[model samples]
Target: MVFAPGEKPGSESEEAKLQIASKQIVQNAILRAVQQVSRESRQREAGAGDTPRGSFRPGAGELTKKHEKK
Candidate 1:
């Protein structure tokens, strides 16, 4: 639904806000993927297996150093 100039579908300011929100959504998704990849790489360096379905343990991979037995 296109809005005519000076007559926004909802409100002019609201349309601008929506545009900013959309941009942030895309940016957040990219950031999350990058972080996940970095984590996976570190896991590989630690000799952890690539198992996606198993329960996430603290020391499953790179997290080994981070989570020691209590």
Candidate 2:
């Protein structure tokens, strides 16, 4: 089935809102992927294997540090 020819699609304001929302969704996805790659690289450099697939702790990476104490 398709929309009838006489039926109105939507208002111009609604169309503009939809466009803005779609762009925001795409941008959010790209940013998240970049952040994930950055985190994984840091883990590798720190000698930690791939991060486990689970909830990410806020500051678990700090524990892996080797502080020199006198």
Clashes of each: 0, 0
Local distance difference test, candidate 1: 0.79
RMSD of 1: 9.8
Local error of candidate 1 at 17, Å? 1.2
User: Model 1, 2-64: lDDT tens per residue?
Assistant: 777677566657668799999999999999999999999998877655556576877446646
Looking at model 2, which ten-residue stretch has the lowest summed lDDT?
Answer: 61-70
Report, for every candidate in turn, its global Cα lDDT versus the true structure.
Answer: 0.79, 0.73
Over 1-70, each residue of candidate 2 has an lDDT whose tens digit, in order, gives 4444565565345567899999999999999999999998887877544556575869755644365354
Model 2: residues with Cα > 4 Å off, grouped in runs: 1-12, 48-70
Alpha carbon deviation, residue 20, candidate 1 (Å): 0.3
